[model samples]
Target: MPVAPAPPAAPAYADPQGSLRASDADRDRIADILAEALAEGRLDAEEHAERVEAVYRAKTVGELEPIVRDLPAAPGRTAAAPRPEPVPAAYGPEDVEGNADQLLAVFSSTTRKGRWRVARRTNAFAVFGNIEIDLTEAIFAQPLTTINATSIFGNIEVRVPENISLRGTGTGILGNFEVTSLEGVDPQAPLVVVNGYALCGNVEARPKRGKWVVDLQSKIRKHLGH
Candidate 1:
């Protein structure tokens, strides 16, 4: 007798507010779940990559439900969990440490941003080019991070989270070395040190701010005069 394959497992729970927006942290959590599944032999490399990509592409909590439906829940967490607040997009640098340690821009431009792991010490070089290092959406692999930069006839702009602590010192020979003053910054936060030289170029660092997103609830609230 021909028998059909068993049906896929059902979701643990119903998604009540499926339309609710998702956050970076939520996506990261889903990715973590997928990674564990891959490590446990439940998913292959190709499947894991595809699922991880879907996680980043997801726009709402409901969209993430199916990808991890058959996988085990994360430790200390449930299979059907509420989305947490967004966190800086960063991952552990254990595997990538000592790999791709430098960002060089030669007569061109380079950028690093969005859910990336930054090494403990990184070098940013720009020669007649532009280099942008956006750590606002990045994760630091260590508690202390040092970015050594060198810009000659080029520009280097770095953006960090507003709550993180910062310490920097550099020289600009016929160029500019400008960093935002740290006021009301958290003292216990991770330390980021930037030191380098800029010749006929610009090196600037500033805080990152959130961009507004329009949602259905916001529109409803406006109509209701809330």
Candidate 2:
């Protein structure tokens, strides 16, 4: 029999968070990085524009890696050896982690949404109650945040905006633990890891909508200098 070829190793820059989404700010940061590279003669103008367009269209960090993989880091930065895999740190220095926060609901319902600062580590609990966490307008303390949640005879729900990445590894024992956003992730985007257990209850994660409208409104306000 002929020898079978070994499978290729996975790219290291591949988004470990899985199908998480990207954000406008994430895209802008990459664009800035590309712009800097262009000014520094690391990338030609054509390549820079092309990469910027792709950056805007990119829904995840995985899509943004190849654009600058071959370019050298800024003048002051130490360049690491090149590999066949993608490198998350090569993108820039803005993707740092944040502090820690917590949320809990016991025999009642607790909801957190709107614009708020998220810690690097967040602990959420729902015991005979309900808990909802929405990150549509959240400001993360770090580029990657971990959410540890537990639901017992209650419900725990997480709502994230599009383009942000989510890795949900929660398990359910005689209950339900579901993660709806697990496709087309970006390694450079903010990573939110959802982990925990649900007992006789439900734990779910999914994406939100209407961010474009918000973006448009912000642009209009800025255009008018309001």
**Highest lDDT against the true fold, candidate:** 1
What does candidate 2's lDDT look like per residue over 61-102, in tens digits?
667655566666432345786523323321223334433467
Q: Each candidate: what lDDT?
A: 0.67, 0.64
Candidate 1 lDDT over 124-223, as tens digits, reads: 9999999999887676664446677899999999887776645566789999987764421222234455767899999888777761111323433554
State TM-scores per candidate. Answer: 0.50, 0.52
User: TM-score of the candidate numbered 2?
Assistant: 0.52
Lowest-sum lDDT 10-residue window in model 2? 83-92
For model 2, the superposed segments whose C-alpha errors exceed 4 Å read: 1-99, 183-187, 212-226
RMSD of each: 17.0, 13.4
